[model samples]
Target: MKIPFYRPYIGDEEIAEVISAIQSNWLSKGPKTVVFESEFAKSVGSEHGVGLNSCTAGLHLAQLALGIGPGDEVITTPYTFVATANTIIHCGAKPVFVDIDPKTCNIDADLIEQAITPRTKAIIPVHYGGYPCEMDRIQEIAQRYGLAIIEDAAHAVYTKYKDQPIGSIGNITCFSFYATKNLTTGEGGMITTADEELANRIRILSLHGMSRNAWTRYAAKGAWYYEVEQAGFKYNMTDIQAALGIIQLRKLEEMQMLRMQVARAYSEALADCEEIILPHDSHEHRHSWHLYPIRLEEDQLTISRNEMIDQLSEAGIGTSVHFIPVPKHPFYQEKGYRMEEYPETEKVFESVLSLPFFPGMTKEEVYYVADTVQSIISKHRR
Candidate 1:
């Protein structure tokens, strides 16, 4: 009866891949990492991929590669994780926050142009909970203004925006392979782009800004000497992570199917419930269902969102919130970001609750969660 929030569907294949990586004795950014980068890029229909230690690293590198620095402004949503904004700060740029579209919980594309200034350099659109932003509108705006698009696709590995994969649309797209993600490599990330020069720059920046071929310098055929092109952080992915990523990438479709099944079950079970608003989905944009965040209609329920979370915990059903909004955080507040500016984000934050959703959740568990939620709502009805 104890259902945890998320349990990664790691199998024997992942373990075997790790073992193989360990046996190969080439652990640091070697052939396996290279292969994983290529395969992941191909899977998402991107021309190039650069593997890194984390999605944050990929985001940071994306900004650096685009020459976004001091005095520059990067427009993004206040509804996303702080990493999306933090990367902009790391590049010595200011993150201009835009409000979210309450329906999709993504940046309101209509509001983006108003936030743009002469200093505006790029747009970082986060596909919140795997539901893609309105890319067509965003793209049109970017093209008109000559602004770069960097997609924060941490929750959108398998997501598609109108038949075009998330990775292939933006100038640069970053994906996360954290433990809780649908496709996990324990802790890893990749950046996908169509520009070969950008890809090479990202690869070089990921590892101390060494020569593009420096990763292979220690190999049997590689030379011992290399030169540093720029001062970059050590953000390279290891062969071990890439080995696991290879198998995980291969199993992505299988895992995504299971996630979709669980999402459908939740929607079907709660379709009649007026006290909650289910996550958004559509035919044109394929949702990856990374986090099944449901919003409580607090006006109809006596219990608050936090109280409901406590109740779920008491019932042994683990739950979480997808995000707390970047502007609401203390760090961002100190930097002059105010919550009052993001009314939509604050409204969504007050009622949103992420349910226990994972690829391998059983029917019994799904029903138990549904029944528990219903029972709680019935007892707390106004």
Candidate 2:
């Protein structure tokens, strides 16, 4: 009866792959990592992929590859994980926050124009909760403004916009392979881009800016001497993580189907509840269904969002909130980001709740979660 918010879908295949990686005795960035990068690029409709230790690392490197640094500004939505904005700061650039669309909870493309300034160098739009942002419009803005598009697609592994994969649309797209993500390598990420030059730069930067990686320099046919190209951070993915990534990538479709099924079950079960506002989906885009977030109509319910979460926990059903709006965080607040400037994000944050969702959840478990949520709402209704 105890249902956790997330559990990685690892199977015998993943175990075997890890074992094979162990047998190779090459745990650092090796053959498996290279193959994972290639296969992942193909899966996302991108020409190249650079594996990294975390999505944050990929985002930081993306900004660096685009020459974004001191005195520059990057526009992004406030209704996302802080990493979206933190990455901009990591590059010694300022993060310009924009409001979100209430419906999709993604960055509102209409509001982007006003945020642009002379110092603007990039626009990092997050595909929030695996829902595709208004990419076409965002692209038009980026093109007209001469800004780079670095998509924060951590929650959007298989999402698509206008029949094009998410990874292929942005100038550079970052994906997460965290334990809770749709596809996982426990703690890893990948950056994809169609530009080969950018890919090469990212590769070099991901592994400490060395001219050659350990795998290459130590190989039989490889040279022992290599130059230090640039001062880059240590953010390389290991062979063990890549092995897990390969198996997870192969099972992605199968896992996605189950995720969709759970999403539908939640939607159908909660459709009749007036106190609940379900997440949006459209025919024009493919959502990865990574997180099934629901909003409470506070007017109809006496309990606050926090109380509702507590009630769910009491019912043995775990839950989470997607985000708290970046501006509301102490770091951003101290940096002069005002919550009032992002009204939509602030409003959404107060009511949004992510239910227990994952590929491993059976139909019965899905319904039980729905029932628990309904019971909590009914008891709290005014």
Candidate 3:
């Protein structure tokens, strides 16, 4: 009964779709990806969705689209996966770190103002573990500062804050269809936006800044005359990857409904547990529940988070930590971000652990995880 911490829910459909793409002979950024981008945009209520090789690429291009570069600072949270902050650095922009809401592990909107300056060109808010951040307040803050917002929605595919989907509300929202994500395309991402000019710029930027994309340029009836306006990376999504995305996107809401069910079960079973603190939903937002992370009541439990992970592993149940504060990572530390600067992230990082979560897990498997967790916590009661 070995339960892996995360698994991609792929079936024959993914395999068959890839086979169909191979048979179609237009594998590179072809019709399938175009259809996927359009369908994904419609589903998320975004005006445009540009598919890319990875969420990092999407974030980078979003910054490039907004004309953000060196000397510009993007305010963001320190509690996230390093990719969120690293993307800003990749764009040659400085990332201004802010502490998080100890509960949701999202950037504290209250503290964003203190970090803003004339150099703050944008704010990148990470929707940690598919839970929506305080977007209204964050948006208001961005408006007051006249700053653009590039959302790190890597963990959020279906999450909504108030009346808007996370992707639709932000100026530029990036989503990862990574192997362990709610919906996956093996490895790919999307950048959603309402800015048509920005969207057109990103579309070109993703395809090597070509005036005409690969599909249009290589088609039999297409003209050979095309020009590169600027240097850009090859970040276009392949048709094979987009084929999988089409299947996943169509099944997204169904999968999300099940994820919520799993979250509710975990919450109900562990809510009253003495040594665990369950995650909380946002004030006016819906969570996609990508990961069900629990906090160890360190004082009440003799075993540390690492020890608990080891215990879960020994019991044939898998688990992981959502993040280890980005600033604490060696790479960020080398870039001048200190652990002491983000107290809330440091506090959350010390005690958090991500439990196994995916749509494929059976009811019995979920119960085994929950029961094993309770037994381990009880065994190590301090």
- Once fitted onto the true fold, the runs of candidate 2 whose alpha carbons sit more than 4 angstroms away are 212-214
Report the C-alpha lDDT of model 3 over 72-168, residue by residue, as the tens digit. Answer: 9999988888888887888899989999999889999999999999999999999988888888899899998899989999999998887688889
Candidate 2 per-residue lDDT over residues 79-196, each given as its tens digit: 8888888888888999998899999999999999999999999999999999999999999999999999999999999999979998999899999999999999999999999999
lDDT per residue (tens digit) for residues 177-250 in model 1: 99998788889999999999999999999999999879888899999999999998899999999999999999
Off by over 4 Å in 3: none
Error of 1 at 17 (Å): 0.8
Cα lDDT computed for each candidate against the true fold: 0.94, 0.92, 0.88
Query: With candidate 3 superimposed using the best TM-score fit, by how many Å does residue 282's alpha carbon deviate from the native?
Result: 4.8
Best by TM-score: 1
Question: Residue 176 of model 1: what lDDT?
Answer: 95
lDDT of 2: 0.92
Best-to-worst TM-score order:
1, 2, 3
- Give candidate 2's error at residue 225 in angstroms: 0.7
Query: RMSD of candidate 3 to the true fold?
Result: 1.3
Q: In model 1, what are the clashing residue pairs, if there are any? A: none
Q: Cα deviation in Å at residue 197, candidate 2?
A: 0.6
